[model samples]
Target: MSLSSTPPNTSTPIEDPSVYLDDPNRKSLEIDTDTHQGPALFRWLTLGMEYLIGAILVALIVSVSSNVVGRALFNHSLPWADELARMLFIWLVFIGAAAAFSRYEHIAVDALVRRLPLRLAHMLYLLQHLIITGLMMVMIWGGYQVLERSSGRSAIMNVPLSFISLSLVLCVIFIAAVSIWRMWVSLNVIRHPEGER
Candidate 1:
């Protein structure tokens, strides 16, 4: 006796991820990390950022939870908990953003671009990445200035304020590098749409 609630449809073939590259008309996001295109070092950096973001998130949770429990049960607060949590939260946001950008996971409105010719679409993509790179450069400069001027420590934890600004600078630097690389890829596709892979 078969234990199936309903028979599966075995006639349909599984779609291969590589097929997207072969079809110019396919307008899909590349969500598979196995097929990620980049130098090994860059890929490693993105993976590291993802791991760091997770660790920071866990630390942030623990800090807040311990403080809450202490206040409720012991009628005493962990003074350093709030400051540590805030610092971890800042790191999480910046690192998470960099990881998301590396994977092209950020929200974007590309309906019009999807409908355009492949070369024309890539032209727009190149322009978009150029603007992003420029903005990131400005952010890096501003972050560096802030880091230099931030001489004070956190109120309770005594952690240096420059540590917080360092996160912003590092995040923008990675994002800017990614933007430049993406711009180069877009430029290549514009020059040779048939050679895209």
Candidate 2:
């Protein structure tokens, strides 16, 4: 076949990691060696608070279970135990969600992007964060409105519904902030001198 007429090969060899590993001349690239103390302290404090709340939740669960068991055996029911358990559960769910958001451990599907090019993958990550942050802001605003409207009402134990609603407001704000922070970190990584591969 003439050189100009030959069909081009469709397959190309993938870049070898060994090239970078074996080359001594290439300078080792370090990303984000400088620690931002404020973010680090916030992260640690948030995690510590989550752990404390988790311990309280465990204690609440154990106490509720014991009360329920004792009441069942004694043919009597504790009126406040169920309500307290429900409130504790609500607290646990919201606080747990906040913790997950802070840690970037929320559920997501990335199967389609896994096969894409690196730049596209990072772009997709940014897009996801943008959507998340927008949604969280909306939720925070809506939750605050609801809390304000329901401030005078009280739950079965005379607890204000607004108090519980405030948790939703806080959770949304925290989720949005965490999403934005993570996006900032990712952008910084992309802009680093040794850009992400």
State which candidate has the highest TM-score.
1
TM-score of 2: 0.71
Q: In model 2, which residue pairs have backbone atoms overlapping below 3 Å?
A: none
Segments of candidate 2 deviating more than 4 angstroms: 1-38, 153-155
Each model's backbone clash number:
0, 0
What overall lDDT goes with each candidate model? 0.80, 0.66
Candidate 1 per-residue lDDT over residues 2-54, each given as its tens digit: 69898887787789966433334323223235776576667889888888888
- Structure candidate 1, residue pairs in collision: none
> Model 1, stretches more than 4 Å misplaced?
1-32
Residue range 34-142, candidate 2, lDDT tens digits: 3432376456746675786879688788869877887879877777677777777777788888776655456645456555555455556667778989999899889
